[model samples]
Target chain A: MSKDAFFALGLLAGLMIAAWGLGRKAFKSKHYDEMQLKIRATGYRIGFFTALALMAVLMLLFELDCLGIVSPAFALLAVLMVSITVFAVYCIRHEAFLSVDGQGKRYIALFALVVLCNGLASALRLIRGEALENGRLTLSFGSPLLMTVAFLVILAALLIKTVKAGKEAAE
Target chain B: MKNLKMKAARAAKDLSQEQLAAMCDVSRQTISAIEKGDYNPSVNLCVAICKALGKTLNDLFWEE
Candidate 1:
């Protein structure tokens, strides 16, 4: 695989670690309640449908971009923005933060760390005339990294929330 | 649709919903929901609440 894909794989590993941490946090929080369970079930249902529709639209857009009717840069940015927005709304509405207790704060800190590292990497690429073209900071790599981290946070929230419900049921 | 019997039994015991829930190892909301008839707990939870309140299952959970 390409270096970018490899780096994304490593980030994916971090995402899974984050999900596990959030699950552990929720399991030990003592804050999971029945209301949260109903809310999470509804949220996941909504998220599944929303994600499915978004992916279908993205697939069509990608096809158009490949055919040169749409720009790849615009499609990537649009997907990244839409994904983050949808996930943020879903997590907020479901109150994942309540179940995971302090996990929201921890996820934010981790995201900040990821952004700082990505910023430095982008700067290094810019200095070497590698990541910038046409006077535009080629966020070619930034798009995936940001989307991945946002997705990681949402996935962790979903994981912890769902697991908390399952744990309560098992108890 | 009130389970006035359970309410009266709980009052006789002078125990709050939270106390009963703790004794039953459940959330206070679960106890409240049971009392309100908003939820029908399982037989196990019914038995647990009956024991916590020092009443029989029929006294707490049976509908006349």
Candidate 2:
């Protein structure tokens, strides 16, 4: 297999595992309380808004690329990144990011693992003496960087929410 | 408006929020939120809570 194709296959497997873990809670909504369902609905609403905004931004950037102003591949990567960002943002927000609960800690730890994976990916590339790319595991829509970006977004939202909640608690 | 009636009923039954939540098959936060007037539960949940408290819906949920 071509390097890109092999990379894509590996990325697909990793993403599938992660997606299963993330979607497990959502798919088992029947087991959740009305309050939990309500929170999940809030996540969908926030995700809708985030996706809409990303679409608008992508449109503008795509036009710029059409004008010979930017590289071509970046536009596709941007689309993938935006999608993961929306999912990450919505899930983190609805979960009350960094909540003082076991589930919250698990999400936080997963976010940390994403960063660690990025480091490992980069380190592997260096060992192979290949040019390092920040977020392009396979290019097109098959980038593992999509997951990393999503995790980073979750981390960012959690930190911000944690600080805000702390202040609210003090008051 | 908050459901102080339901809260009072639960209290009279000597039930903690967690115990009442278990009886209603809900989280304690949901029960607490209901009492705080932050959440309006479904009819089914209301009926369940009513049964658990040994009260009529009119006694706990309805004002009149």
Candidate 3:
């Protein structure tokens, strides 16, 4: 198997494991609402389909010799977008965002931030003509120094927000 | 946290949390959690509980 194929397989396996863990936690939790259960199930389904689609697309691109080693980055971005869309739909359907609880609002905001970051990164890559390599697109940072700084800033913000949200929920 | 307990006000009512859960289309665990004060039901869920118990939200939830 090619390196790209191996990487794709590894990603799929990791996703599957994470989905299983989430499912198990949902099942064990006594306070999970029906809507929450449905959302969790939908997330698992999306993960499965996303993995399948990624592998299929990667294989096709490889066969066509259109796969750039760096091109998988675009596909990864696409998959992340799809996942965020799925989550947003779930939240809307469940009316989770309308609650007075801060936790729900925080979750919605966090997902929105992720979607925005992914969109910005994708646009930047497109403008720079660096989206794909052979046919495989992998994520790339324009400059190592800049990327590190940006990553740290985002990570810190998210962590702080998450901690505050948890405290509010507990109170 | 308050020690919340969903005690049966009267045995003649004979309503189990499981029965209430089924009537409301929620998992039994949700009902259990609510009774134990471990979970807070959403507005829709609170309404469902009131409907199932033939009582108002104030009767079911508020402490006297």
Best of the candidates, TM-score: 2
Residues B1-64 of candidate 3: C-alpha lDDT, one tens digit per residue: 3324344531235876557777887755467667767667788998887777677778777777
CAPRI quality level assigned to candidate 3 from its DockQ score:
incorrect
Candidate numbers sorted by lDDT from highest down: 2, 1, 3
DockQ score of the complex predicted as candidate 1: 0.25
Chain B superposition TM-score per model? 0.93, 0.95, 0.77
Give the candidate number with the greatest DockQ: 2
**Is candidate 2 or 3 superior in lDDT?**
2
- Whose TM-score is higher: candidate 1's or candidate 2's? 2
| Fnat of each candidate | 0.10, 0.50, 0.30
Cα lDDT of model 1 by residue, A5-94, tens digit: 565567668879988987786667645455445545666676566757766887886666642433345355545555555645565544
- Ranked by DockQ from best down, the candidates are 2, 1, 3
- Write one digit per residue (lDDT tens) for candidate 1, span B1-64: 6678888999899988768877887665567677888767778878888888889988777778
Q: Please give the TM-score that candidate 3 achieves against the real structure.
A: 0.38
Q: Tell me the TM-score of model 1.
A: 0.50
When 1 and 2 are scored with DockQ, the better candidate is: 2
Candidate 2 lDDT, B1-64, residue by residue in tens: 7889998998899998879988998866678789989889999999999999999999999876
Task: Give the candidates in order of TM-score, highest first.
Answer: 2, 1, 3
Tens digit of per-residue lDDT, candidate 2, span A98-127 = 332225456667778876787566556556
